[model samples]
Target: MDHVQHLIDLLRDDLTAGRYRVDLVDGLWGDAAAAALFRGQTEPAVRALDAGRASGTPSTPVESFARLFLLGQALPIGEVAAAFPRLRVAGAEELGLVVPAGGDAGRMRAALDLRPYSFVDTLGAGSWWVVSDLGEAVLGRALDKDHVLGIGGASTTLSGLMIPTPVDSVLDLGTGCGIQAMHASRHARRVVATDISQRALDIARLNARLNGIESIEFRHGSLFEPVAGERFDRIVSNPPFVITPRVDGVPLYEYRDGGLVGDALVERVVREAADHLTPGGIAQLLGNWEYRAAPPGSEEGGSDGLERVRSWVESGGAELDAWVVERERQDAPSYAETWIRDGGTRPGTPEFAALYGAWLDDFDARGVREVGFGYVLLRRPAEGARATASAAPTPAMARYERVAEAVGSNPAGLGAHLEACLAGHDWQAHRDDDALLASTLVYASDVTEERHYWPGHDDPVVMTLRQGGGFARTAPLDTALAAFVGACDGDLSVRALCAALAEVLGVDESLLVADLLPAVRALVSDAFLLPAG
Candidate 1:
């Protein structure tokens, strides 16, 4: 522990003094090299680093650190020593971050992946030095079963989706390198991060200390075992939800595969999360579901993937509000190919072929035709908010849809937008038609209307209300609805607007009010229209 603390202090000082960061490293290599690095091709970045060295120009500590760690290249012991001056090569060896190169006492190579990760959140921008097990690119072979992963695309996605609303406590289940937990610590008063792998916990602990963040409590267990009988105000997980076949000789990656058959791990997480959340608490996660073809003699062919997720929520023993979005879908073969390639198996190779076959056989046994990947948000109702068993009452809020479209320019952040959308849903839920008609609304600034008309016609044949941000939703509008939306400046009540539109269109006011009420409610729920004073 003493040695680890010393190493952490040295690393913090080195990174701070050297100014090792994303922008500086990118500027050092130029755009093309940075793009190549992003695509997992390190040759361009290596060449650029070598060029800087060969020019006989003195290298900055930032450049030396990037080459030795970020690029996974060896450097002379003397150069590393100069970059670290404080920790020195001896201290680095003690930290197990580097080892002497073969037959050369003057050179050293990294034993782990240490890189600078930067991001912007509700708190503003910050960077941290994250350490994890070396990846396939650095190892030049398949990863060990217990390998821990550093920040990746999935990590960023889940982090970005995390709602930034202040909370008392948060649970980061399946915390890998502690990325999610660290993000949660920014808003929550306390955070608990758990992982099934001890190695992951070790690295995550190292990361928390390295960043000077101490509010996160690390626990060792799978899923919710560590937090049994406890509840949190918010829960975030990017679990090992990869659907891997349970067969011989198929390597199960600790970072991705949870050793479950066909998306069961994700289902289990969904079902169990209810017990660990406070009333009105939110659980956000990313998952993949199998869309099986309907069984023989069934009214519908295989089960719908999104509906399966809905069933999981319903079986949770709690009346949970669910908002599920299926962002992308892939057929069986394509899904198999993608995951197989992800495991460091190259296509057109014997090993790849065998693993691909295993995936297909597994899918065939399950009758799976396609796989859908998406984000899920589940919220437990507040006290007395749940429906009673005596009545077959409708859920106040439940949305399950396929929003595969791109989100527009989201300057305010997606997490904030989603939180607001949920609040909007709840606000509209308790209002009946009469109450809705009595309300006034203002159009969201991000929303605009588009019209297409015949060549010379003044009136548009088609009218669409499009949101510039927040899911980039667009709703087709009819003549009366379009006019009503245009007049929603919060100055006129919904009832007044309907009355005026009816008079202008030469129609009965009562009928017009009835026709536009449902659409008005939908608009309000979706944030296209907002409640006004």
Candidate 2:
């Protein structure tokens, strides 16, 4: 362990001195290589790197490091030694990061994938070197069952969605590679990261040590098994929610497929999360839900994907608030093709065809017409607000919607925006319509309006209220509502704005207020409007 720590310190120093960063590496390889790398094709990147080396100039330390680890290319032992003068080849071998290639001491290959990851959050910009199992690009075949994943699209997505608010303790369920747990360590006093795979736990622990982060505690168990009877102020997970058929010859990749038929794994997480959250605590996760089709001539339709998630939360009996956003939906065939290809199976082959058939058969057996993939946010209510007589009147806020459109991008990420939106919801939840009307409100700074008029007409045909951030919501606006929103400059109360608009439109003030109150509440809840001082 001391040797490991010494090697990690040397590695960190070498990586920092070499300026091994995401942007610099991208610049060195150019856009084509970067794009090809994203598509899981390394030929372009390899060619670019080789060309740079063939330019008759010595490769820089950063370039050598990227070629070996980022692109999974073998490097000469001399070059590896130069890249890490402090650790050298012997130290890298001691760290299990590289090994002799074909019993040749002159050449070495990376045993694991280690690359620099940089990001900007509310706390500011920083980077870390993450190490994980070599992927298909390096292995040149399907991943092993216990393969651990490095930074990927889903990992970054969940990280960006995490609320960065300070907290006492956080639970990172299914903390593969410890990416989310490491991020949580930045804000929480302590973080408990649990995973069923010991291999994953080991790699995650190494990552924490490599980055000099000591606030995360690693545990091994599936789902809530490890953290039983324990609660956290915040929880985040990107679980193995992929739907796969339970049949022979179908490999259950422990990194993804959770050995569950359909989307039961995600449902189980939602159902069990309430038991592990403190009052007013929150759990954010990524999941997949099955959207089944209605049977022939049946009056009652099949289960809705979003509603199924709602049912899981309801069954928890915790009166938790849930906000589920189905980011995208894919049909049965498309979904099968995606996960099948993801497992390194190529099209136009017998093996691919067999897996595709298995997926279709499984979906058909369960009457699954489509699969909806999305983000879910669940919150346990505060103390004294449990499902008792005193709290019986306030309905558990459950928002389930399909937001397939692009949300506004935030440079600091969306976590802060989500935190504010939740606060807005809670603020409006306690106020009656009359109370809300009596309160003054201001349009959020990120909001703008657009109007489309007919070619030769004075009246506009279309109006939209657009939000620049926080899910980038756009709502259709009528003439009266548009005028009312325009007048909300923090100088007038909601009631005064409605009354003035009603007078201008020659409508009854009471009727107009009744008509606009619901929309007003929605706008406020979504952060398009805020309460004025």
Candidate 3:
């Protein structure tokens, strides 16, 4: 224990002194090369690295580490020692980070993928060293069923969506590599991270300790089994929610596939999250919901995946507030192919064909037409909400929508936007129409109005209101509503703006206010406009 602890300290010092950072790496290899590497092609980056070195030997610390770690290339022990003088080659071997090359006893190769990850979130800029299993590129074969994955696109998505509000405790349900738990620790006083796979728990613990974050506590068990009776102030998870077929010859990778058929894993997480949260606590997660056909001769018709998620919240309890955004949907073939390739299975192979057939057969048996992938943010209603100005507060939010816009990187993520929107929802939900009319609103800074005209006409034939953040939503607007939105400069109350528009359009003031009030409330809920400061 002491040896590993001492080695961890030495490793941290070496990483810091070597300037191992995402941006620094970009500077080293250029953006084009870095992007090519992300797409599973390392040639461009390898070319750049080869050009920088003389006689195939790394000349710098970051370059040496990148060659041995990220590029999965063997380096001489002398180069490894020079790269990390504090934690030399022997220390790295003792820490199980590197092993002597089989072909050449004098060379060392990375036993793990240790790289610097940098992000700018709700809590400013931060960087950390993440350690996880080597990828298929390094392993040169399909991943083992229990292989622990490193950072990927899903990791980036969940980390960006984490709310950075201060809380007493957070429960990270499936702490794969402990990424979300580390992100949670930035805001929470303490965090409990749980995973079903012991290997995953081991990697997560090493990752948390490597980053010098002490607030995270690691536990081993499946789903909520690790922390059943306790409640937390916040919960975040990127669970093994992938829908995989339960059949012979199908690989069940612990990192992606839960031991369930179809999308039941995500359903279980959504249904049980509220029971594990305190009052007003929020749960943020990514999920896949299936669009299944209704049975023959049934009164209820088939529904989209978003509606299915809505049913999960309703069945769970009334105290839960849910905002589900379906970002993408895929048909059976596309979804099957995606996950198949993810496990390093190449196309036109027998194994790929067998797995793909199994997936389609499973979907067919379940009557699933398509699958939806998106974010699910749920909140437990606080009892104090009724004590505010209104005699009866509105029920918890159960809104669902589909968002398809390309994400913007302004604040790097939507946590701040989500936080603001929740606050805006609470502010407007307690107010009746009259109260809402008296309140002032201003369009968010990222908002813009788009006008389309017909061949140089005097007026626009079509109009739209677009938001640059918080799901990157865009709404079609008629002339009157566009005028109302344009007039929202935080100067006058909604009542005054509606009345003025009504007078100019020669319509009934009451009718205009009635028509505009619903749109106003929706805008507030979706965060197109905000309550005046």
**TM-score, one value per model:** 0.95, 0.96, 0.95
Q: Comparing candidate 1 with candidate 2, which one achieves the higher TM-score?
A: 2
lDDT of each residue in 183-226, candidate 1, tens digit only:
99999999999999998999899899889999999999989999
Badly placed stretches (over 4 Å) of model 2 are 294-300, 384-392
Name model 3 segments beyond 4 Å from true: 54-58, 294-300, 386-390
- Angstrom error at residue 511, model 3: 1.4
Cα deviation of 402 in candidate 2 (Å)?
Answer: 0.4
Where does candidate 3 clash, by residue pair? none
> Model 2: per-residue lDDT, tens digit, 9-53?
888888888888888889877998899888888888888877877
lDDT accuracy of residue 100 in candidate 3 = 93
lDDT order, best first, reads 2, 3, 1
RMSD (Å) per prediction? 2.3, 2.1, 2.0
In angstroms, how far off is 436's CA in candidate 1?
1.7
Name the runs in model 1 displaced over 4 angstroms: 295-300, 386-396
- TM-score, candidate number 1: 0.95
Q: How accurate is candidate 3 locally (lDDT)?
A: 0.88
Candidates 1 and 3 compared: the better one by lDDT is 3
lDDT against true structure, model 1 = 0.87
